[model samples]
Target: MALLHRAELRPSKLELLVPWLPGRPWFAGEAGAEVTRVAAYRFDDPAGEVGVETLLVRAGDGPVLQVPLTYRGAPLAGADEHLVGVIEHSVLGRRWAYDACGDPVYPPLLAAAVLADAGQAEEYFEVDGKREMRPASMTLTGSRTGRPVPTGPVSAGPVDSGGTVVRVGEVELAVVRQPVPADVPPAGGLTGTWPGQDEPVLLAYAR
Candidate 1:
């Protein structure tokens, strides 16, 4: 389960994304655009050391964007290029956030999600030392040909079609940074669907 804390965050996630978005080649937002969170989902780290979450945000009426992030207690070694900045969490203290594609923990978990058809982990909140379950807003579906384990460091290529290729060893996982029309062919990697959506949104695919 993904545990959430009802604590304050300095320079909230949205605040960090505002400036960060413009620097991304795949971002289609206008300068000073307003962004709102539409939905989100989380993947549990088996070791419980990393916090993995994917945010779906809309920028000034533009298409929804997918931003997968990984929260780590300590800086991820050799991931300076992917750092999204640090933030102070009321409950967790300071955290280093990085683009999930560049983290070693993310690709393997993503592979498991796709190949095993794993659902997003259930969310929970801790109150007075008690845990309460919370509903997840999105569902993820994965392809059948995914490898069970990640083999090497991740390398990202240029963005295209609102997506980017994240290479983990021999596997190329297409990380979709924006939502496209449902009519787009599903090449079979990772897809997600949320409430009020007419069709499944493709998030990633293995090539």
Candidate 2:
């Protein structure tokens, strides 16, 4: 389960992504186009220290883009290159967000989700010391049967229009940074759907 806080974020997520997305080789939008968040999902960290979430955004009429992000109380050691930017949290003070592809926590948890056919984590908000369910903005599903891959440090390769390959332990996972066209081959791993979408959209796959 993931806890949701009713906190304010300075330079909200959309603000951060607007500038960051265009720099990514896989980003399909115009460099300075307006970006809007379409949907989002999350994964729970067993230790409850890191915040794991993936956002699907669209720029104008462009295809939806998948961007996974990790939030930490402090900078992740050895991952300066992946830092998206720092944000001031109303309740937590400050947070450092990084590209999930470069954060060590994301790959293994994603691998476990794919191999175990797990759905996105359940979210709850604290109210008077009691937890109440908070509906997620997106629905995510993983494949039911796949070989369990050990999770480990992730090394991200150069991203291109096609996608990027990251080595997670001994497993190689391919993240589809851009939306897959209708004629494209079916995704082989986790998928998601949002309001008004009847079909599951590919998020990532194990290679």
Q: Please, what is the TM-score per model?
A: 0.90, 0.91
Clashing pairs in 1: 114-142, 189-205
* Model 1, residue 203: C-alpha shift (Å): 0.5
Candidate 2 vs. true structure, TM-score: 0.91
62 in model 1: Cα distance from truth in Å?
A: 1.4
Summarize candidate 1's per-residue lDDT along 6-74 as a digit string, tens digits: 989998998888878878888876656877888898999999999999899977777889998999999
For model 2, give the 10-residue run with minimal summed lDDT.
179-188
**Worst 10-residue stretch by lDDT in candidate 1?**
180-189
lDDT tens string, model 2, 116-179?
Answer: 6677889899999999998889776777665666766678866788777777788777778874
Model 2 Cα shift for residue 60 (angstroms): 3.0
Total clashing pairs for each candidate: 2, 0
